[model samples]
Target: MFRIFVIAVLPLFFVFSSEIFTFLSGALCPSCNCESAKPLHRIPRPQLRPEFLALENGTDARLGCEDVGYKMHVFSREPLVVYFENFVSAREREHLLDISEKIYTPSTITHNGGQTSDRNTKVRDSEVALVPRTEGVRCIERRAREVQGWREEVWIERLRVQRYNPGGHYSHHFDWSSGRGGWGRVSSFMVWVHGEELEGGGTEFPRLELRGDKKKWCKFIECEDNLDGEDSKDKGVETAEDKKGAVFKVIPGNAVYWENFRSDGTGRGYNETWHAGLPVKKGVKVGLNIWSYGRID
Candidate 1:
């Protein structure tokens, strides 16, 4: 009996010792014997410095961000589309506008066999300006980086501010046409910097299917673009949201984020993400894009 008891206790002791060794080594999870995981997909964190300056024009902003009330409203699960409220602070928006002066030229398009076209074309029309990195600019970058959940091989592109005057538009297009050397755009964030007094410039993803409270969603989406009684706000209603698509309203301080690639770990451009910047028909609208990439390596 004593020998049997010793044998049973020995196995238990060895198992407990192995777990303690694994924990102390800090190389693998003690319980699962797998690699320790790092945190990702964090919330945005804005720069709170009392004074921030723009690197491009030396324009300064006098404000601090103790906290950001930016809220994410999910619109899709497969391709991961989200709408953010209060994504940009008022002071940062002003700084972006100040730096854009004299910097914008007639926008052009590059498609099909290296050909280029001016903003008057039927597909796309908007003046684009690259945002120089400043403290204020970095504030936005930090937020995007946090929200995007950085990886070792992935990096964010420099911000590009786009100005769409009345009649400006961009037809359906993919942000990641193809991966270059195994790298490609994986996510996109479109931030509305300044667009008050503007109308008819909504971002639309014609392939997405959206459904929610009509009254709440209309404030953020172009709900009136296409709606029928079949797609009622009431529950248990047989709806046809797939045909209606998703159109985001042009709201100041708000933004839209979505995955540009397939979610199946392929890093391929998602066909369902084909989106368009609807024509601006009434007033000028200024927005910014934060694009991130993924690598196959």
Candidate 2:
């Protein structure tokens, strides 16, 4: 009786197992057609989009500063003013002037009493044009950030191109604002973009005094000539014999960088950073002001 039961159960198991195997095989390879049961190969991956391919290949094409070199001379340490020779390339200067030729408008100063206003003022008599962020302009901005020892480009404000004609000047003022809230300018880079045989237009820091070699500074500053005795007392003129500070001449491709904030925790404006752009007495002077702020905004 036990052998008979085993035979019956074995046949039923074989028949059921065959049916299960056949069902699974059909589910997995429905299109096998029974001619071959070979494993299916993976479908070829879709080709990457053209934009994606371009992005993958662009990492090696970025610009570098390997060919750029510049000279720096310390003008003052208290307010941290440094003069840079050949800060901007000749081509960059020409490009800036060409792009901004028709965009110049009367320049405005920060409102008195720490208010915000865009009205034109006599305090700043030059015309200004904001240089758009083109590739050339971006290169100059990056160079400026490197010179300042800053790693981030966002700290820089928009580049300002200023045109000063005869008698045009900016009265003595501090670059950093005295009010609270948003960050004020921490430093400034003023570049002389164009000036040939330019006279009288110079950046004067009345509160800063330098005892360095006069001849050496002559290359970067106007150390040879003193302000005319009569002009020294003029209300608009801040630098005179009685009031002595370092004054940098307007030399093409050269720039003066000065720190506007104190080192203290308060981050207040440094008194020695007070400066003015003297009247342009001769040829036209075109300058670029690159201001770096404490905050990115």
Candidate 3:
């Protein structure tokens, strides 16, 4: 009986050995959620609001009119930077501008413990609108969350819309906060809404470079500036960035998304993620900031 069983099992083992090994390895191996396991690349995402959940009703759903057909292109993989075209619709841009105008405050910067004007033009010189989660805002939040493919422990910060006049700008800075702000930002999503004839006001990441995708990148960034771009003021004076990083131009309805932390699961800010909002040389510019965070350490 034993000889017969061995003879029968020998052919079966040869035929399904690979599948058996794969199944056994997966079933007996250490679980991915173990403490020693590597952290996931994606962040935790929030669930959708009820309105978005009613999509089964099709065209009658509240989201029917808000449907967008945006496309995403990867610019960097190490720090995970991506560009989104047509992320915000024209009607949504108008709505954001209207709502922001009603609630914006002159954003201030600190200098030697004293307050500076929103028009300082030194660090961040722009009016800020900490928008409440309205219908439009919620729709955006839902879209942002969906785009990221996150659905874990959810924490999305308030949407901040910064209004920049001709001379306005946000200087070099990192979005991640190490101290009082808690576990720091997980990632950042920024969108542009420029008025007619808007110039300059591009988001510059000095240390980040673009070496490939030449043709596709032109639509999202200024291709003429080499690896690092230099934008001149209205008077032909060069801006601070001489030759280090790349600049993403103010393309209305377009967005820039990047991970804030290093990929090691240390939850530390990646230095390459540092960026600045270059000064606005001409017309008005409004930018939206959507920051996401994981739970406290």
- Index of the highest-lDDT prediction: 3
In model 1, which range of ten residues has the least summed lDDT?
A: 48-57
lDDT of 3: 0.71
Per-residue lDDT tens digits for candidate 2, residues 1-297, read 999999889978887996767677656754333433323332333333332111113332364533446788887776688888888888889999998999998888766533575744567889998867666777776777667676332266678899999888998987777423435566888899998988898988867876577656666655434356455445455432333677788888888888875544343456677789998899899999987754312
Worst 10 residues of 3 by lDDT: 51-60
Would you estimate the TM-scores of all the predictions?
A: 0.69, 0.69, 0.68
| Ranking of predictions according to lDDT | 3, 2, 1
Cα deviation of 205 in candidate 1 (Å)? 0.6
Model 1 per-residue lDDT tens digits across residues 251-296: 9889999876553333345666888999998999999988775553
* Model 3, residue pairs in steric clash: 206-245
Compared with the true structure, model 1 gives a TM-score of 0.69
Cα lDDT for residue 295, model 2?
A: 38
Clash count, predicted structure 1:
0
| Candidate 3 positional error at 228, Å | 21
lDDT of all predictions, in order shown?
0.70, 0.70, 0.71
TM-score of 2: 0.69
